[model samples]
Target: MKSLNSDAFRMSIAWSRIFPHGRKEKGVSQAGVQFYHDLIDELLRNGIIPFVTVFHWDTPQALEDEYGGFLSERIVKDFREYAEFVFEEYGGKVKNWVTLNEPWVFAHAGYDVGKKAPGRCSSYVDKECPDGRSGYEAYLVSHNLLNAHAEAYEALKKCEKCIGSKVGIAHSPAWFEPHDFKDAADGASVDRALDFMMGWHLETTMKGDYPAIMKEIVGPRLPQFTQKQKEKLKNSADFVGINYYSSVFSNHVEKPDPSKPMFKQDSLITWEGKNVDDISIGSQPVTAALPVYARGFRKLLKHIKDKYNNPEIMIMENGYGEHFGNKDSVAVGTADHNRKYYLQRHLLAMHEAICIDKVNVTGYFVWSLLDNFEWQNGYKHRFGLYYIDFNDNLKRHEKESGKYYKEFLSQGVRPSAIKRDEL
Candidate 1:
């Protein structure tokens, strides 16, 4: 971060590392506690602020073994303890805290799709999944995660040392555009899609309950927060952290069969990478993320501003992921023209949201500093500004994009100020 002229850095601590058995009763690791303090001290010494994410989907194995993680309400109490422990420990040094990073991703990918840790999904969704209630578990997990986040926020607010700290959950929401701009059904689907993805949590946090559309669609499958829980959730965050990557087209589904249940199907919206004419919505081909769609980003920001009474926001994670496969040439990696283009475009879009749209965006952080292990994708997809040589003792080399970021950070250059062709 110091080398890149960055002002703040974001990181997460492994839950099991702090409480080896995932509970304070098991015993706390003084060494594990000290490690983060040392790291925070180092970041502060280098003139960089720290944004600590309390939970980044690394639920302790023991917790999962004792009881299904997040699926059971029991996990909520443990999560609160874990969250409070960290807030109390580092409250004096770390002023910015994220209760959880992408609770939606954790719930859906982990419980619905069975692609992530503690993976579980209905046999119909992923035949290999050992066991899960696809539609039911995801909602249960999300409900617990939200409560955990709310409790954590309350804990931080009460802590004298952390009184002034800004705490929020980092939500990952993709911008969903209508497949056909003139199609009313498609346009409504776009709103439905947002309600399913972003509003599932955002609305709960902002309005003290879930979106009305979600309640009508998901119905009994959706979990309800108690009146007390609702009070805790409303205005839980001092600010909102959005981790946006790509945009997808939402087309209305004429009829969705409720007999065969799945969390995704409840939306009654099909998220398509390409529009009705099968055209890419961005500058590049559709891949893990829809190609760079800067305008979609602006739209998303504006929507948040208008719909959620825009508190404050930070672009927590935004970057492009390229699957280089087995290709391992430093010369090939360092060039990274596409990655640089991705950064420039997204940053420019965010700038427009901040300056022209008058959205209260406080900061932007690129997806990563180094190409590391991505969940399920593993290291196949590289999203980092810096390239890592996995086979060669994990040596790090700055890509062209990294150099460009350093210049942009140091010179206070808006991404729009530089011509794309100049790079």
Candidate 2:
């Protein structure tokens, strides 16, 4: 990081690593606590600010077995206890903290789609899932997650060591545009899509309630917050953390079948990479899932600025991922021109948002500094600036993107001759 001129590093703490049973009363791992203390000290010694994430979807199996994890309300109290332990432990050292990272993805992907950890979904949604209500469990999990965040925020406030520290949740929201700009229904669907994806959690933290559109559509399945909980939740975040990667077109679904209900279908919209006229939103890189759409980053930032009273914002995670199977080689991975280009475009977009649009943007951290295991994909999808050679004693080779980032940071900006579209 010092070689690259990087000033800040964002990392997450594994809940299971600290307390094996997800409760401090069970047992605390002194080794795990010391490990982070050393890490924070090392970063500070190297002139790097540490932005620590309290929870990043690593729920302890003990809690999962006891109360089905985030699915049950009981996890909220456990989460509060666990978070308090962390705040009390590292509060004096780490100032920037993220209470939760992408709660929406944890709830929707794990419970509704059943593709992530502790996979649970209705048999109709995914027959492999152990047991879950497709549309129902996601909302319930999100409710508990939100409540947990509020409780953690309250805990942070009370910690004497956490005086000048700041805390927030890192939200991963994709910017959505209408598939058909000419269609009024499609335009309306865009709002609903944003409301369901980002507003579900963002609005709750800002205003202490779910989006009105969500309540109208999901109805009773969406849990309600008590008056005390609402007060605790309102303005809980010190800043808004965004994890932007790509954008998609939202096509309006005139009539979603009520018989087959799921969280994805609740918004009555379908996502498309291309519009109705067969125009791609942006360049689709080798990774099929994430399309390159830098403009979306600027638009999303402006939307947040205008909609949510212009809260301080931080780009928590944004990077390009490439898939390289057995054919991977140092030569091929090191010459990552596409990843470099992706970073350049997004950085330019962020610049425009901050300087021109006056978005209260503060910090921007890349998704990763080194190639590491990516959840379900393992080591197949690489999103790191430094290529990790798994076959050769875990050697690290700085890629073209890393070099470009170093140059960009050293110079503090790209050349004035370079235009936004030129990249």
Candidate 3:
């Protein structure tokens, strides 16, 4: 990363890695603790800021077996203990802390939709899932996750070594546009979609509760925060961390089937890559699930700025993913002009958000630095500036996108000097 003139690296610490079980009382791994110590020291030595995530959806199996993990309130106490342990251990070295990474994804995917680890969903939604309530479990898990974050934040405040540290949750919310701009309902769906997607967790940290729309729609399914929990949750984040990938067109669902209740249907909207006119959102990349729409990126920033009083923000993760089969050679992987274009356009959008809109964005980090084992996709999808040869002892090869980023950073161009159309 230093070679690419990158100054910061965002990484997550697995809860299982630190505590083999769930709690520190069970057993703490000295090797695991030392591993992070060495890694943090090396990053510091290279003058790179380390933004460490406390938890990244990896709940220790012991906790799951004991109390169903985040589905139960018991996990909150354990999470707080784990967070406190880390805060005391490396709090002095790591100033930027992410309490949780994409809690929305974790709860929705793992508990509601059953796409990721510890997959649990209603049998009707996914027969493969062992057992879970489609709409109910996600809300319960997210409720606990919010409380866990509040507890972690409180723990951080008490840690003397972490006095100067900044902590927040990394929220991955896709930008949404109305499928039919002419339809008022479609436009209303966009706001409802954002409320369900981003505001569920975000508004909790800001206002100490979920969006009022969610409370009314989800009703009994959505968990309510206690008066004490509300106080702890309000203003928990020092900064907002956003992991944006793509934007989608949101069409209003006139009436969802009451029989099949799920989190997605709860919002009464359907997300699409094409508008009502069948026009694509923007340019859809071959490997990307959603189309590239940089305009949505700027709009999303402005939305957050206007709604949240322009709090400090960080682009935690943004990049292009490509599907490369075994037959694809290194030459094809190295020539990633599409990825470069994606980066260029998004960066320009972010620049517009900062300069013209005056959004208080502090830093930006790409999705990845090297080809990694993406969860669920495994190694099939690569989203990295540097290509990895899994066949040849994991050899590293820099792609065109890497060169573009390196040059982009080396220039150190001021925002005022950038021409709007040049990018």
Candidate 4:
């Protein structure tokens, strides 16, 4: 494998690395800033573009303790100040900016039915509030997230002559399918499925607010947005970065109970010869690792194009890997053949969006360059093309999949880069 390159390769700046405690008074670490300055140069020197995301959910522990982080509106200004600082100092070196990476996942995973960071909302009713996370607070958090993003977008737009590009957010969309194809109840479940996963984010970023169905169904439980805020929320993103993983099935069920919290998920699966419920309430099992629905990738792209007026879109996070022993390849490493084909197929879909659908698809970045500390899963599920040997030795061996990616780039078909192999 040879020559691998791209106009842009994104890298993250861990929040804790700088603030350590997530506080403004702690002072922005020059070391963190310098690391990226050096990284941006390294990419440039190799003829690769540098795309940077200021916040990727590594909230300073300091912020979390003060008032539950994003749970409170206090994070808006704090986040803005941090973003402003980065734009002012590094705008000269970097062009592309992502304000928040998957605010939905951050909110859902971090709160509500807590699995990620800073943990739960605790109270049941507030979980239904706009600021609530989990499935309920999707509105409050998303509303604030959008305003924060817009404020940052506005700030970045003002300095466009300096930054020289647009600012956006990356959202992971979980595709949904009806549980019972012939049952009307199952079809209704798919709507609820969309509401919980994909619809929640799309409404805010694209339509400029949460879905109307939230109010129609949840009634007063939905968060309130002012007229001015509504305007600001609309058209906030200069581009949309979508992370497509897998699809699920949605089945309608009784309204989510405030007391007996259950995590019901619409799954494209079954048990004992019965199709799994299209929608579940609170605590539901993730039957399969990730629903193997590749076609949903194309439908979502088309949906984005038609629904969002073809806003500049990029597949920011889309890569697959295996965890259990070795699947097809066992060259003493990870990187399953399914992952290689998954990436290649998605990239082709992206090309279709560009060639036929006439979507303003910008660029695509695989989920990770290597298998690293995957939050809760903790390196259990490897999603990297390059298998990371985090065993006693942190050796990174380019797997067959990595070799395939390198070949794709070597064909002179991708953005230019000095291949690590060639180097």
Tens digits of per-residue lDDT for model 3, 110-189: 98889998899999899999898899999999999999999999999999998899999999998888899999999989
What lDDT would each prediction earn against the true structure?
Answer: 0.85, 0.89, 0.89, 0.65
Candidate 1: list runs displaced more than 4 Å.
Answer: 1-6, 285-290, 419-423
The residue pairs found clashing in candidate 3 are none
Ranking by TM-score: 2, 3, 1, 4
RMSD of 3: 2.0
Q: Give every collision pair in model 2.
A: none
TM-score of each: 0.96, 0.97, 0.96, 0.83
Candidate 1 residue-wise lDDT, 199-304, digit = tens: 8998898889999998998889898999999999998988888998888888888888766677778888777878998887776643333477878888999999
Per-residue accuracy of model 4 over 85-153 as CA lDDT, tens digit each? 778777887777788888878766665556666555544534533333344554456666777787777
Clashes of each: 0, 0, 0, 24
RMSD of 2: 1.8
What TM-score does model 1 achieve against the real structure?
0.96
Q: In candidate 4, which residue ranges exceed 4 Å CA deviation?
A: 1-6, 21-23, 121-139, 160-163, 188-192, 254-288, 325-335, 412-423
For residues 84-107, what per-residue lDDT tens digits would candidate 2 score against the true structure? 999999998899899999988998
